[model samples]
Target: MRTAICSGSFDPITLGHLDVIRRAAACFDKVWVCVSPNAEKKNQLFTPEQKLRLVQAAVADLPNVEAELFPGLLADYAVDHGANVIVRGVRNATDFDVEYQMAIINRGIHPQLETMLLPASAEYQHFSSSMVREMIRYHQPLEKYLPASIIPLVRDMTERKGE
Candidate 1:
């Protein structure tokens, strides 16, 4: 069966992320949403486990999709998971440029794996986890950028932070 891995530091899974996963699921026989742990991002609210759970909750309806946490090189994770494709979501030209370079490097490391970029839906093209968190921090409405279930969690986190 054809398998693909979607890797990101989904500190908080946003609707845009879900849309990308949904699209990837339709293309690959099996899709694994791999949450990468990044110690460099100090403001991250969710741990890798927390992020995995959120992604699992968000994509629960997709039978062919699963969520997990992975560390180290993304290409290494893809190889370990038996995935031949790395699915990425591109929201703008800037993202495309960076992702393109990363894809080239990944290809150089694992020539068998291919990176596929999917454009974000126009409505969510500008939505990002950091943006959503910033809005929630300022008591702004995030009903559009996040799933209903995630709003409460974000609110709770913001409240705890006194933001």
Candidate 2:
């Protein structure tokens, strides 16, 4: 079975992230929506637990996709999940620069693994997790950038954190 891993911090899974995950599902038999472990939880708007739950809830309907936590190198995570491809959603030239370098390093670490840089859909091309976080921070409208289910969860988490 061909499997892919879509790894990200996914502080809060934005619509763009979901778009990539959904697109990845169309190609790979199984897609792992793995959240990379970030030790700087305080800086993050949502805790790891929150992120996991959000990711799980967002992807629950995709029979071939799963949300997981991985703290190690992505290549190792791919190996653990038996994934041959890593799905990356590149929205612009800037994103390409970063993903390109990481793809090279990942290839060096695990020669057999491949990186698939999927372009963002036009509607979500300009949005990102950081942008969404900033919007949430400033109480900006998130109707276009975030999935409907995630908005409430972010609100609840922020309210609980007293933000």
Candidate 3:
């Protein structure tokens, strides 16, 4: 079976992320959305467990999709998970540059693994987790950028920021 790893910090999974996961599901037998815990981002709104739960809830309908948390190198995690491919979503040129550099470095570490980039859907071309977080912080409606189910969670988190 062909398995692919979609690894990200997923501070809070947004619609753009769900879009990528849905698209990746169609192309791979199994698509694991691995949430990585970054030591550098300790102030992340969602804890690793919360991120995993959110991802699981978001993709629960997808039979071939699953979510999990992993710490350390993403390439190593992919190999350990038996994934031969890495799926990434690109929204623009800047994303391409960053993902491209990581892809090259990942390839150098694991030449057998391939990275596939899917262009973001037109509606979500400008959507990002950080943007969503910022919007929520400012009390801006995020109906367009986040799944309905996630809006409440994000709202609650952002509201707590002021307390």
How high is the CA lDDT of each candidate model? 0.87, 0.88, 0.86
Candidate 1, which segments miss by more than 4 Å at Cα? 157-163
- Compute the lDDT of residue 49 as modeled in candidate 2: 79
Please list the residue runs of candidate 3 whose C-alpha ends up more than 4 Å from where it truly belongs after superposition: 41-43, 156-163
Local accuracy of candidate 2 as per-residue lDDT tens digits, 1-163: 9999998999789999999999999998999988986775446888777899889988878999998887889999998889889999998999999999999999999999889999999998987787788888888887888788777888888878876
Ranking by TM-score: 2, 1, 3
Task: Give lDDT tens digits, candidate 3, residues 1-163.
Answer: 9999998888788899999999999999999999998888655777788788778888989999999998889899899989989999999999999999999999999998899999999989977887776776678887887778777776666567661
For TM-score, candidate 1 versus 2, the one ahead is 2
CA RMSD per model (angstroms): 1.6, 1.6, 1.8
Write model 1 residue lDDT over 1-163, tens digit each, in one string.
Answer: 9999997998788999989999999999999988999877778877677678778878889999998888889999899989999999999999999899999999999999899999999988977888876776678888788777767766776577677
TM-score of 2: 0.94
Q: Which one wins on TM-score?
A: 2
User: How far in Å is the alpha carbon of 84 misplaced in model 2?
Assistant: 0.8
Give the TM-score of each candidate. Answer: 0.92, 0.94, 0.90
